[model samples]
Target: MKKNLIKPIVAAALFGIATQSALAADRGTPREARELFDQAVKFMEANTPEKAFAAFNDRKGRFVRKDMYVFVIDDKGVYHASGAAPEALVGLTVLNTTDAAGNPLFRQMIDSTRSAPEATVRYMWLNRVTNKVEPKVTYVHKVGDYVLGVGYSAPRASADDARGMLTRAVDLVKKDGAAKAAASFNDRQGAFVKDDLYVFMVNMDSGKFEAMGMNPALSDTDARGLHDAEGHALVAEMIDKLKSAEDATVEYVWRNPVTNRVEKKRSYVHRVGNSLVGVGHYIE
Candidate 1:
Protein backbone atom coordinates (compact mmCIF):
# COMPACT_ATOMS: atom_id res chain seq x y z
CA MET A 1 0.00 0.00 0.00
CA LYS A 2 2.80 2.39 0.83
CA LYS A 3 4.60 1.66 -2.45
CA ASN A 4 1.43 2.23 -4.46
CA LEU A 5 0.70 5.53 -2.70
CA ILE A 6 4.25 6.75 -3.24
CA LYS A 7 4.13 5.94 -6.92
CA PRO A 8 0.98 7.96 -7.49
CA ILE A 9 2.23 10.86 -5.37
CA VAL A 10 5.52 10.95 -7.20
CA ALA A 11 3.76 10.79 -10.53
CA ALA A 12 1.53 13.66 -9.56
CA ALA A 13 4.47 15.74 -8.44
CA LEU A 14 6.33 15.10 -11.66
CA PHE A 15 3.23 15.93 -13.66
CA GLY A 16 2.83 19.21 -11.80
CA ILE A 17 6.45 20.15 -12.33
CA ALA A 18 6.24 19.30 -16.00
CA THR A 19 3.10 21.37 -16.37
CA GLN A 20 4.73 24.36 -14.66
CA SER A 21 7.81 24.10 -16.84
CA ALA A 22 5.70 23.93 -19.94
CA LEU A 23 3.71 27.00 -18.92
CA ALA A 24 6.83 28.97 -18.16
CA ALA A 25 8.32 27.99 -21.47
CA ASP A 26 5.24 29.20 -23.27
CA ARG A 27 5.00 32.52 -21.44
CA GLY A 28 7.13 35.48 -22.48
CA THR A 29 10.30 36.28 -20.56
CA PRO A 30 10.92 39.75 -19.15
CA ARG A 31 13.54 40.30 -21.79
CA GLU A 32 11.17 39.15 -24.49
CA ALA A 33 8.47 41.43 -23.13
CA ARG A 34 10.88 44.34 -23.11
CA GLU A 35 11.96 43.61 -26.66
CA LEU A 36 8.38 43.51 -27.82
CA PHE A 37 7.84 46.80 -26.04
CA ASP A 38 10.88 48.23 -27.79
CA GLN A 39 9.50 47.23 -31.14
CA ALA A 40 6.30 49.06 -30.37
CA VAL A 41 8.29 52.10 -29.28
CA LYS A 42 10.31 52.03 -32.45
CA PHE A 43 7.15 51.82 -34.47
CA MET A 44 5.73 54.87 -32.76
CA GLU A 45 8.92 56.88 -32.94
CA ALA A 46 9.43 56.07 -36.59
CA ASN A 47 5.91 57.07 -37.53
CA THR A 48 3.49 59.85 -36.79
CA PRO A 49 0.76 59.38 -34.19
CA GLU A 50 -1.81 58.92 -36.93
CA LYS A 51 0.29 56.28 -38.60
CA ALA A 52 1.19 54.54 -35.37
CA PHE A 53 -2.41 54.67 -34.26
CA ALA A 54 -3.56 53.08 -37.47
CA ALA A 55 -0.90 50.41 -37.30
CA PHE A 56 -1.81 49.56 -33.73
CA ASN A 57 -5.46 49.43 -34.66
CA ASP A 58 -4.74 47.18 -37.58
CA ARG A 59 -5.16 43.47 -37.10
CA LYS A 60 -1.64 42.85 -38.35
CA GLY A 61 -0.10 44.40 -35.26
CA ARG A 62 0.28 41.16 -33.31
CA PHE A 63 1.60 42.91 -30.19
CA VAL A 64 -1.51 45.03 -29.88
CA ARG A 65 -3.73 42.11 -30.76
CA LYS A 66 -2.32 39.79 -28.10
CA ASP A 67 -2.34 42.39 -25.33
CA MET A 68 -4.42 45.17 -23.93
CA TYR A 69 -5.52 48.35 -25.56
CA VAL A 70 -2.97 50.64 -27.27
CA PHE A 71 -3.36 54.29 -26.66
CA VAL A 72 -1.52 57.60 -26.26
CA ILE A 73 -1.89 60.49 -23.88
CA ASP A 74 -0.52 63.99 -24.08
CA ASP A 75 1.54 65.68 -21.37
CA LYS A 76 -1.64 66.97 -19.81
CA GLY A 77 -3.17 63.47 -19.80
CA VAL A 78 -5.47 63.89 -22.74
CA TYR A 79 -5.97 61.05 -25.11
CA HIS A 80 -4.21 61.90 -28.34
CA ALA A 81 -4.46 58.60 -30.11
CA SER A 82 -6.25 55.36 -29.28
CA GLY A 83 -6.49 51.94 -30.84
CA ALA A 84 -10.12 52.77 -31.06
CA ALA A 85 -11.08 55.61 -33.33
CA PRO A 86 -8.35 58.18 -32.80
CA GLU A 87 -10.65 60.94 -33.99
CA ALA A 88 -13.03 60.26 -31.14
CA LEU A 89 -10.33 60.48 -28.48
CA VAL A 90 -8.24 63.25 -30.03
CA GLY A 91 -8.98 65.75 -27.31
CA LEU A 92 -10.69 63.75 -24.55
CA THR A 93 -9.18 64.08 -21.11
CA VAL A 94 -8.24 61.15 -18.85
CA LEU A 95 -6.55 63.05 -16.04
CA ASN A 96 -9.67 62.76 -13.88
CA THR A 97 -10.58 59.16 -14.58
CA THR A 98 -9.68 56.39 -12.19
CA ASP A 99 -8.37 53.12 -13.46
CA ALA A 100 -10.69 50.16 -13.24
CA ALA A 101 -9.51 49.69 -9.66
CA GLY A 102 -10.00 53.35 -8.71
CA ASN A 103 -6.33 54.35 -8.79
CA PRO A 104 -5.36 57.62 -10.36
CA LEU A 105 -3.63 56.26 -13.45
CA PHE A 106 -3.10 59.58 -15.17
CA ARG A 107 -1.36 61.24 -12.26
CA GLN A 108 0.89 58.26 -11.71
CA MET A 109 1.87 58.18 -15.36
CA ILE A 110 2.77 61.85 -15.35
CA ASP A 111 4.84 61.55 -12.22
CA SER A 112 6.69 58.45 -13.33
CA THR A 113 7.43 59.78 -16.79
CA ARG A 114 8.63 63.04 -15.37
CA SER A 115 10.94 61.33 -12.91
CA ALA A 116 12.40 58.75 -15.26
CA PRO A 117 12.25 60.32 -18.65
CA GLU A 118 13.58 57.26 -20.44
CA ALA A 119 11.87 54.61 -18.37
CA THR A 120 8.42 53.25 -18.91
CA VAL A 121 5.78 53.12 -16.21
CA ARG A 122 3.96 49.83 -15.69
CA TYR A 123 0.57 49.69 -13.94
CA MET A 124 -2.60 47.67 -13.69
CA TRP A 125 -5.97 48.52 -15.12
CA LEU A 126 -9.37 46.90 -14.88
CA ASN A 127 -10.57 45.79 -18.23
CA ARG A 128 -14.28 46.40 -18.04
CA VAL A 129 -14.90 43.97 -20.87
CA THR A 130 -13.04 41.12 -19.24
CA ASN A 131 -13.80 42.36 -15.73
CA LYS A 132 -10.18 41.60 -14.97
CA VAL A 133 -7.34 43.86 -13.97
CA GLU A 134 -4.38 43.56 -16.30
CA PRO A 135 -0.89 45.03 -16.47
CA LYS A 136 -0.24 48.09 -18.60
CA VAL A 137 3.21 49.32 -19.58
CA THR A 138 3.63 52.79 -20.93
CA TYR A 139 6.62 54.69 -22.33
CA VAL A 140 6.27 58.43 -22.37
CA HIS A 141 8.44 61.07 -24.05
CA LYS A 142 8.34 64.77 -24.64
CA VAL A 143 7.51 65.52 -28.25
CA GLY A 144 7.41 69.28 -28.69
CA ASP A 145 5.16 70.73 -25.99
CA TYR A 146 3.22 67.50 -25.54
CA VAL A 147 4.18 64.18 -24.08
CA LEU A 148 3.84 61.18 -26.35
CA GLY A 149 2.56 58.16 -24.49
CA VAL A 150 2.43 54.70 -26.04
CA GLY A 151 1.17 51.76 -24.07
CA TYR A 152 0.59 48.02 -24.27
CA SER A 153 -1.57 45.92 -22.00
CA ALA A 154 -1.46 42.28 -20.95
CA PRO A 155 -3.00 40.14 -18.22
CA ARG A 156 -0.88 40.51 -15.10
CA ALA A 157 1.16 37.42 -14.39
CA SER A 158 0.89 35.70 -10.99
CA ALA A 159 4.43 36.65 -10.03
CA ASP A 160 5.62 40.04 -11.13
CA ASP A 161 7.69 39.44 -14.27
CA ALA A 162 10.85 40.86 -12.66
CA ARG A 163 10.61 38.45 -9.74
CA GLY A 164 9.81 35.65 -12.14
CA MET A 165 12.90 36.50 -14.15
CA LEU A 166 15.00 36.42 -11.00
CA THR A 167 13.47 33.10 -9.99
CA ARG A 168 14.11 31.65 -13.41
CA ALA A 169 17.66 32.84 -13.04
CA VAL A 170 18.03 31.02 -9.74
CA ASP A 171 16.62 27.89 -11.36
CA LEU A 172 19.16 28.19 -14.14
CA VAL A 173 21.91 28.48 -11.57
CA LYS A 174 20.70 25.40 -9.77
CA LYS A 175 20.30 23.45 -12.97
CA ASP A 176 23.79 24.24 -14.20
CA GLY A 177 25.34 23.55 -10.80
CA ALA A 178 27.95 26.23 -11.34
CA ALA A 179 28.59 29.72 -9.99
CA LYS A 180 29.71 30.92 -13.40
CA ALA A 181 26.25 30.17 -14.76
CA ALA A 182 24.86 32.90 -12.54
CA ALA A 183 27.29 35.40 -13.96
CA SER A 184 26.69 34.19 -17.46
CA PHE A 185 22.94 34.50 -17.06
CA ASN A 186 23.30 37.98 -15.62
CA ASP A 187 25.63 39.00 -18.42
CA ARG A 188 23.25 37.69 -21.03
CA GLN A 189 20.51 39.70 -19.37
CA GLY A 190 22.77 42.72 -18.64
CA ALA A 191 22.78 42.26 -14.87
CA PHE A 192 25.64 42.01 -12.43
CA VAL A 193 26.27 40.77 -8.93
CA LYS A 194 28.69 42.00 -6.31
CA ASP A 195 30.99 39.15 -5.28
CA ASP A 196 28.99 36.33 -3.66
CA LEU A 197 25.95 38.30 -2.49
CA TYR A 198 22.37 38.41 -3.62
CA VAL A 199 22.39 42.08 -4.41
CA PHE A 200 22.47 42.64 -8.17
CA MET A 201 22.93 45.58 -10.48
CA VAL A 202 21.04 46.41 -13.67
CA ASN A 203 21.69 49.34 -15.98
CA MET A 204 18.77 51.74 -16.15
CA ASP A 205 19.60 53.29 -19.51
CA SER A 206 20.47 50.19 -21.49
CA GLY A 207 18.47 47.96 -19.18
CA LYS A 208 21.42 45.61 -18.78
CA PHE A 209 23.43 44.34 -15.87
CA GLU A 210 26.55 46.19 -14.87
CA ALA A 211 27.83 43.57 -12.47
CA MET A 212 27.46 39.88 -13.11
CA GLY A 213 27.62 36.96 -10.69
CA MET A 214 25.59 37.61 -7.55
CA ASN A 215 23.10 35.72 -5.42
CA PRO A 216 19.54 36.60 -6.30
CA ALA A 217 17.51 35.40 -3.32
CA LEU A 218 19.23 37.10 -0.42
CA SER A 219 16.95 40.09 -0.19
CA ASP A 220 13.64 38.23 -0.04
CA THR A 221 12.25 41.30 -1.75
CA ASP A 222 10.64 41.53 -5.14
CA ALA A 223 11.94 43.93 -7.79
CA ARG A 224 8.75 45.98 -7.83
CA GLY A 225 8.90 46.57 -4.09
CA LEU A 226 12.55 47.50 -4.32
CA HIS A 227 11.78 49.80 -7.19
CA ASP A 228 9.18 51.52 -5.09
CA ALA A 229 11.69 52.17 -2.31
CA GLU A 230 15.00 52.95 -4.02
CA GLY A 231 14.64 52.83 -7.76
CA HIS A 232 15.12 56.56 -8.13
CA ALA A 233 17.92 56.70 -5.63
CA LEU A 234 19.81 53.90 -7.30
CA VAL A 235 19.46 55.63 -10.65
CA ALA A 236 20.76 58.86 -9.16
CA GLU A 237 23.69 57.12 -7.58
CA MET A 238 24.69 55.48 -10.82
CA ILE A 239 24.72 58.81 -12.60
CA ASP A 240 26.83 60.49 -9.93
CA LYS A 241 29.31 57.64 -9.85
CA LEU A 242 29.85 57.87 -13.62
CA LYS A 243 31.26 61.42 -13.65
CA SER A 244 34.92 60.75 -12.84
CA ALA A 245 35.11 57.16 -13.93
CA GLU A 246 34.06 55.87 -17.31
CA ASP A 247 34.47 52.24 -16.27
CA ALA A 248 33.63 52.24 -12.61
CA THR A 249 32.09 49.57 -10.42
CA VAL A 250 30.57 49.83 -6.96
CA GLU A 251 29.72 47.13 -4.42
CA TYR A 252 26.49 47.06 -2.44
CA VAL A 253 24.11 44.75 -0.57
CA TRP A 254 20.53 44.67 0.60
CA ARG A 255 19.20 43.29 3.87
CA ASN A 256 15.97 41.42 3.74
CA PRO A 257 14.34 41.88 7.11
CA VAL A 258 11.78 39.17 6.63
CA THR A 259 14.26 36.54 5.54
CA ASN A 260 17.13 37.91 7.61
CA ARG A 261 19.35 37.67 4.56
CA VAL A 262 22.04 40.07 3.46
CA GLU A 263 22.31 40.11 -0.32
CA LYS A 264 25.67 40.88 -1.90
CA LYS A 265 25.39 43.08 -4.95
CA ARG A 266 27.53 45.36 -7.13
CA SER A 267 26.94 48.39 -9.30
CA TYR A 268 28.72 50.29 -12.11
CA VAL A 269 27.37 53.81 -11.84
CA HIS A 270 27.23 56.26 -14.76
CA ARG A 271 26.80 60.01 -15.00
CA VAL A 272 23.60 61.42 -16.42
CA GLY A 273 24.09 65.19 -16.31
CA ASN A 274 24.14 66.48 -12.74
CA SER A 275 22.43 63.23 -11.71
CA LEU A 276 23.95 59.78 -11.46
CA VAL A 277 22.37 56.88 -13.25
CA GLY A 278 23.11 53.22 -13.72
CA VAL A 279 21.67 50.13 -12.18
CA GLY A 280 22.19 48.16 -9.07
CA HIS A 281 19.87 46.78 -6.44
CA TYR A 282 16.61 48.69 -6.45
CA ILE A 283 17.44 49.82 -2.94
CA GLU A 284 19.38 52.96 -2.15
Candidate 2:
Protein backbone atom coordinates (compact mmCIF):
# COMPACT_ATOMS: atom_id res chain seq x y z
CA MET A 1 0.00 0.00 0.00
CA LYS A 2 2.82 2.42 0.90
CA LYS A 3 4.65 1.78 -2.41
CA ASN A 4 1.48 2.34 -4.44
CA LEU A 5 0.82 5.67 -2.73
CA ILE A 6 4.44 6.86 -3.32
CA LYS A 7 4.22 6.10 -7.06
CA PRO A 8 1.11 8.23 -7.50
CA ILE A 9 2.68 11.16 -5.61
CA VAL A 10 5.80 10.99 -7.76
CA ALA A 11 3.71 10.90 -10.93
CA ALA A 12 1.77 14.01 -9.82
CA ALA A 13 5.00 15.90 -9.14
CA LEU A 14 6.39 14.99 -12.55
CA PHE A 15 3.21 16.15 -14.25
CA GLY A 16 3.37 19.50 -12.46
CA ILE A 17 6.98 20.00 -13.51
CA ALA A 18 6.23 19.21 -17.10
CA THR A 19 3.33 21.67 -17.18
CA GLN A 20 5.49 24.48 -15.77
CA SER A 21 8.25 23.83 -18.25
CA ALA A 22 5.82 23.88 -21.15
CA LEU A 23 4.42 27.22 -20.01
CA ALA A 24 7.88 28.69 -19.86
CA ALA A 25 8.74 27.35 -23.25
CA ASP A 26 5.72 28.97 -24.80
CA ARG A 27 6.84 32.49 -23.79
CA GLY A 28 9.24 34.43 -26.00
CA THR A 29 12.83 34.94 -24.84
CA PRO A 30 15.49 37.65 -25.00
CA ARG A 31 16.14 36.85 -28.63
CA GLU A 32 12.82 38.43 -29.57
CA ALA A 33 13.84 41.69 -27.90
CA ARG A 34 17.16 41.78 -29.71
CA GLU A 35 15.48 41.18 -33.04
CA LEU A 36 12.97 43.95 -32.45
CA PHE A 37 15.72 46.35 -31.47
CA ASP A 38 17.62 45.48 -34.60
CA GLN A 39 14.55 46.02 -36.74
CA ALA A 40 13.86 49.39 -35.12
CA VAL A 41 17.41 50.53 -35.76
CA LYS A 42 17.13 49.50 -39.38
CA PHE A 43 13.91 51.41 -39.69
CA MET A 44 15.44 54.56 -38.21
CA GLU A 45 18.47 54.58 -40.47
CA ALA A 46 16.37 54.20 -43.63
CA ASN A 47 14.82 57.56 -42.70
CA THR A 48 17.59 60.17 -42.72
CA PRO A 49 17.54 62.81 -40.03
CA GLU A 50 17.83 65.67 -42.49
CA LYS A 51 14.78 64.53 -44.38
CA ALA A 52 12.97 63.88 -41.14
CA PHE A 53 13.84 67.36 -39.94
CA ALA A 54 12.48 68.91 -43.09
CA ALA A 55 9.28 66.98 -42.73
CA PHE A 56 8.94 68.18 -39.16
CA ASN A 57 9.48 71.73 -40.33
CA ASP A 58 6.99 71.39 -43.13
CA ARG A 59 3.61 73.03 -42.69
CA LYS A 60 2.04 69.63 -42.25
CA GLY A 61 4.81 68.30 -39.99
CA ARG A 62 3.52 66.08 -37.25
CA PHE A 63 5.04 68.16 -34.44
CA VAL A 64 4.31 71.63 -35.78
CA ARG A 65 2.64 73.57 -33.02
CA LYS A 66 3.05 76.76 -30.99
CA ASP A 67 3.34 74.81 -27.75
CA MET A 68 6.09 72.61 -29.20
CA TYR A 69 9.39 74.12 -30.35
CA VAL A 70 11.31 72.23 -33.03
CA PHE A 71 14.84 73.19 -34.05
CA VAL A 72 18.14 72.09 -35.59
CA ILE A 73 21.80 72.56 -34.61
CA ASP A 74 25.30 72.27 -36.07
CA ASP A 75 28.30 70.17 -35.09
CA LYS A 76 29.57 73.13 -33.07
CA GLY A 77 26.22 73.13 -31.21
CA VAL A 78 25.01 76.41 -32.67
CA TYR A 79 21.35 76.72 -33.44
CA HIS A 80 20.40 76.25 -37.08
CA ALA A 81 16.75 76.96 -36.50
CA SER A 82 14.34 77.20 -33.57
CA GLY A 83 10.61 77.19 -34.13
CA ALA A 84 10.20 79.23 -30.96
CA ALA A 85 13.15 81.60 -31.34
CA PRO A 86 14.95 80.91 -34.58
CA GLU A 87 16.51 84.33 -34.71
CA ALA A 88 17.57 84.29 -31.08
CA LEU A 89 19.47 81.00 -31.35
CA VAL A 90 20.85 81.52 -34.86
CA GLY A 91 24.30 82.34 -33.49
CA LEU A 92 24.18 81.02 -29.93
CA THR A 93 26.58 78.21 -29.02
CA VAL A 94 24.91 75.29 -27.27
CA LEU A 95 28.10 73.92 -25.76
CA ASN A 96 28.27 76.95 -23.50
CA THR A 97 25.18 75.74 -21.70
CA THR A 98 26.54 73.70 -18.80
CA ASP A 99 25.29 72.21 -15.60
CA ALA A 100 26.49 73.17 -12.12
CA ALA A 101 29.48 70.83 -12.49
CA GLY A 102 30.63 72.67 -15.64
CA ASN A 103 30.21 69.50 -17.65
CA PRO A 104 28.75 69.87 -21.11
CA LEU A 105 25.47 68.14 -20.58
CA PHE A 106 25.31 67.35 -24.27
CA ARG A 107 28.76 65.81 -24.35
CA GLN A 108 27.85 62.26 -25.46
CA MET A 109 25.52 63.50 -28.20
CA ILE A 110 27.90 66.16 -29.51
CA ASP A 111 30.79 63.70 -29.68
CA SER A 112 28.72 61.11 -31.55
CA THR A 113 27.66 63.54 -34.31
CA ARG A 114 31.14 64.94 -34.91
CA SER A 115 31.60 62.46 -37.75
CA ALA A 116 28.24 60.91 -38.50
CA PRO A 117 25.57 63.01 -40.18
CA GLU A 118 22.96 62.46 -37.48
CA ALA A 119 22.35 61.56 -33.80
CA THR A 120 19.95 62.22 -30.91
CA VAL A 121 20.23 63.64 -27.36
CA ARG A 122 18.13 64.55 -24.33
CA TYR A 123 18.32 67.64 -22.11
CA MET A 124 16.35 69.99 -19.88
CA TRP A 125 15.59 73.68 -20.31
CA LEU A 126 13.47 76.42 -18.84
CA ASN A 127 10.13 77.00 -20.50
CA ARG A 128 9.76 80.71 -21.08
CA VAL A 129 5.98 80.59 -21.06
CA THR A 130 5.44 78.49 -17.96
CA ASN A 131 8.55 79.67 -16.12
CA LYS A 132 9.32 76.03 -15.30
CA VAL A 133 12.13 73.69 -16.15
CA GLU A 134 11.25 70.92 -18.56
CA PRO A 135 12.82 68.02 -20.45
CA LYS A 136 13.66 68.28 -24.14
CA VAL A 137 14.48 65.65 -26.75
CA THR A 138 16.55 66.64 -29.77
CA TYR A 139 17.50 64.76 -32.91
CA VAL A 140 20.75 66.19 -34.32
CA HIS A 141 21.61 65.93 -38.01
CA LYS A 142 24.89 66.86 -39.64
CA VAL A 143 24.76 68.27 -43.17
CA GLY A 144 27.97 69.46 -44.80
CA ASP A 145 29.66 71.56 -42.09
CA TYR A 146 26.61 72.26 -39.97
CA VAL A 147 24.45 70.21 -37.62
CA LEU A 148 20.67 70.44 -37.67
CA GLY A 149 18.49 69.55 -34.66
CA VAL A 150 14.75 69.05 -34.26
CA GLY A 151 13.33 69.05 -30.76
CA TYR A 152 10.16 69.08 -28.65
CA SER A 153 9.49 69.82 -25.02
CA ALA A 154 7.50 67.43 -22.88
CA PRO A 155 5.04 68.65 -20.30
CA ARG A 156 5.10 66.93 -16.93
CA ALA A 157 1.92 65.14 -17.80
CA SER A 158 3.21 63.99 -21.15
CA ALA A 159 6.41 62.78 -19.58
CA ASP A 160 4.34 60.51 -17.39
CA ASP A 161 2.48 59.29 -20.42
CA ALA A 162 5.72 58.47 -22.23
CA ARG A 163 7.13 56.62 -19.26
CA GLY A 164 3.90 54.73 -18.78
CA MET A 165 3.86 53.61 -22.38
CA LEU A 166 7.41 52.35 -22.22
CA THR A 167 6.77 50.54 -18.96
CA ARG A 168 3.66 48.88 -20.30
CA ALA A 169 5.49 47.74 -23.39
CA VAL A 170 8.28 46.36 -21.28
CA ASP A 171 5.85 44.56 -19.03
CA LEU A 172 4.06 43.04 -21.99
CA VAL A 173 7.30 41.74 -23.38
CA LYS A 174 8.27 40.33 -20.01
CA LYS A 175 4.90 38.72 -19.49
CA ASP A 176 5.14 37.20 -22.92
CA GLY A 177 8.56 35.84 -21.91
CA ALA A 178 10.26 38.11 -24.37
CA ALA A 179 13.83 39.06 -23.63
CA LYS A 180 13.38 42.58 -24.97
CA ALA A 181 10.94 45.15 -26.33
CA ALA A 182 11.95 47.96 -28.71
CA ALA A 183 10.32 51.34 -29.34
CA SER A 184 11.15 54.78 -30.79
CA PHE A 185 11.27 58.04 -28.98
CA ASN A 186 8.09 60.10 -29.12
CA ASP A 187 9.51 62.79 -31.42
CA ARG A 188 12.29 60.79 -33.04
CA GLN A 189 11.35 57.43 -34.52
CA GLY A 190 14.85 56.12 -33.84
CA ALA A 191 15.37 52.94 -31.80
CA PHE A 192 16.43 52.79 -28.16
CA VAL A 193 16.74 49.78 -25.84
CA LYS A 194 17.32 49.74 -22.10
CA ASP A 195 20.75 48.18 -22.46
CA ASP A 196 22.14 49.78 -25.62
CA LEU A 197 24.86 52.38 -25.26
CA TYR A 198 23.43 54.51 -28.09
CA VAL A 199 20.44 54.94 -30.37
CA PHE A 200 20.34 53.59 -33.95
CA MET A 201 18.21 54.26 -37.00
CA VAL A 202 17.99 52.44 -40.31
CA ASN A 203 15.40 52.82 -43.00
CA MET A 204 12.84 50.04 -42.93
CA ASP A 205 11.69 50.33 -46.54
CA SER A 206 14.92 51.24 -48.34
CA GLY A 207 17.25 49.11 -46.19
CA LYS A 208 19.59 52.10 -45.96
CA PHE A 209 21.57 52.87 -42.82
CA GLU A 210 21.24 56.39 -41.50
CA ALA A 211 22.95 57.17 -38.21
CA MET A 212 24.32 55.74 -34.96
CA GLY A 213 24.76 58.12 -32.04
CA MET A 214 26.80 56.22 -29.47
CA ASN A 215 29.10 55.02 -32.21
CA PRO A 216 29.69 57.47 -35.04
CA ALA A 217 31.61 54.96 -37.17
CA LEU A 218 28.51 53.03 -38.22
CA SER A 219 27.64 54.14 -41.75
CA ASP A 220 24.82 53.42 -44.20
CA THR A 221 25.93 49.96 -45.27
CA ASP A 222 27.28 48.99 -41.89
CA ALA A 223 24.02 49.81 -40.16
CA ARG A 224 21.95 48.20 -42.91
CA GLY A 225 23.49 44.72 -42.89
CA LEU A 226 24.28 44.12 -39.24
CA HIS A 227 23.24 40.48 -39.26
CA ASP A 228 25.01 39.29 -42.42
CA ALA A 229 27.77 41.88 -42.90
CA GLU A 230 31.47 41.05 -42.69
CA GLY A 231 31.82 43.33 -39.68
CA HIS A 232 29.27 41.37 -37.69
CA ALA A 233 30.89 38.17 -38.93
CA LEU A 234 34.11 39.25 -37.31
CA VAL A 235 32.14 40.17 -34.20
CA ALA A 236 30.68 36.68 -34.01
CA GLU A 237 34.12 35.21 -34.44
CA MET A 238 35.48 37.27 -31.60
CA ILE A 239 32.61 36.25 -29.38
CA ASP A 240 33.22 32.58 -30.05
CA LYS A 241 36.93 32.90 -29.41
CA LEU A 242 36.65 34.76 -26.10
CA LYS A 243 33.28 33.70 -24.77
CA SER A 244 33.61 31.64 -21.56
CA ALA A 245 30.43 29.66 -22.04
CA GLU A 246 27.84 29.45 -24.75
CA ASP A 247 25.83 31.84 -22.54
CA ALA A 248 28.22 34.66 -21.81
CA THR A 249 27.24 38.33 -22.09
CA VAL A 250 29.13 39.74 -25.05
CA GLU A 251 29.69 43.28 -26.30
CA TYR A 252 29.90 44.04 -30.00
CA VAL A 253 31.14 47.33 -31.41
CA TRP A 254 30.91 48.20 -35.08
CA ARG A 255 32.61 51.22 -36.59
CA ASN A 256 31.50 52.58 -39.90
CA PRO A 257 34.17 51.59 -42.42
CA VAL A 258 33.95 55.12 -43.78
CA THR A 259 33.83 57.24 -40.59
CA ASN A 260 35.67 54.86 -38.25
CA ARG A 261 33.24 55.85 -35.52
CA VAL A 262 32.15 53.10 -33.12
CA GLU A 263 28.67 51.85 -32.22
CA LYS A 264 28.81 49.80 -29.04
CA LYS A 265 26.23 47.08 -28.33
CA ARG A 266 25.69 44.05 -26.10
CA SER A 267 23.73 40.82 -26.51
CA TYR A 268 23.15 37.54 -24.72
CA VAL A 269 21.87 34.53 -26.62
CA HIS A 270 20.28 31.64 -24.74
CA ARG A 271 18.78 28.30 -25.67
CA VAL A 272 15.41 27.37 -24.28
CA GLY A 273 14.89 23.74 -25.11
CA ASN A 274 15.52 23.65 -28.85
CA SER A 275 14.97 27.35 -29.60
CA LEU A 276 17.49 30.20 -29.32
CA VAL A 277 16.63 33.61 -27.91
CA GLY A 278 18.76 36.76 -27.73
CA VAL A 279 18.26 39.72 -25.43
CA GLY A 280 20.10 42.96 -24.76
CA HIS A 281 20.74 46.35 -26.37
CA TYR A 282 21.06 46.20 -30.14
CA ILE A 283 19.95 49.83 -30.45
CA GLU A 284 20.38 52.51 -27.87
Number of the top-ranking candidate, with TM-score as the measure: 1
**Which candidate number maximizes lDDT?**
1
Q: Kindly provide the TM-score of model 2 when superposed on the true structure, using C-alpha atoms.
A: 0.31
Model 1 lDDT-worst window of ten: 13-22
**Candidate 1 wrong stretches, greater than 4 Å:** 1-32, 84-90, 127-130, 134-139, 143-284
lDDT of 2 by residue, 1-284 (tens): 98788656533321122223233332122233233223323433466655544543453344333334345555677654444443334455666565333446555556767767566565565444444455444555545554444443333223234334334433443454422222332113244322122333333333333333334344345433455333455324323433344344446665422222354545443322222223334322
Q: CA lDDT, every prediction? A: 0.46, 0.41
Q: Each model's TM-score?
A: 0.39, 0.31
Residue 96, model 1: Cα distance from true site in angstroms? 1.5
Candidate 1 C-alpha error for residue 5, in Å: 60
Off by over 4 Å in 2: 1-64, 99-103, 106-108, 155-284
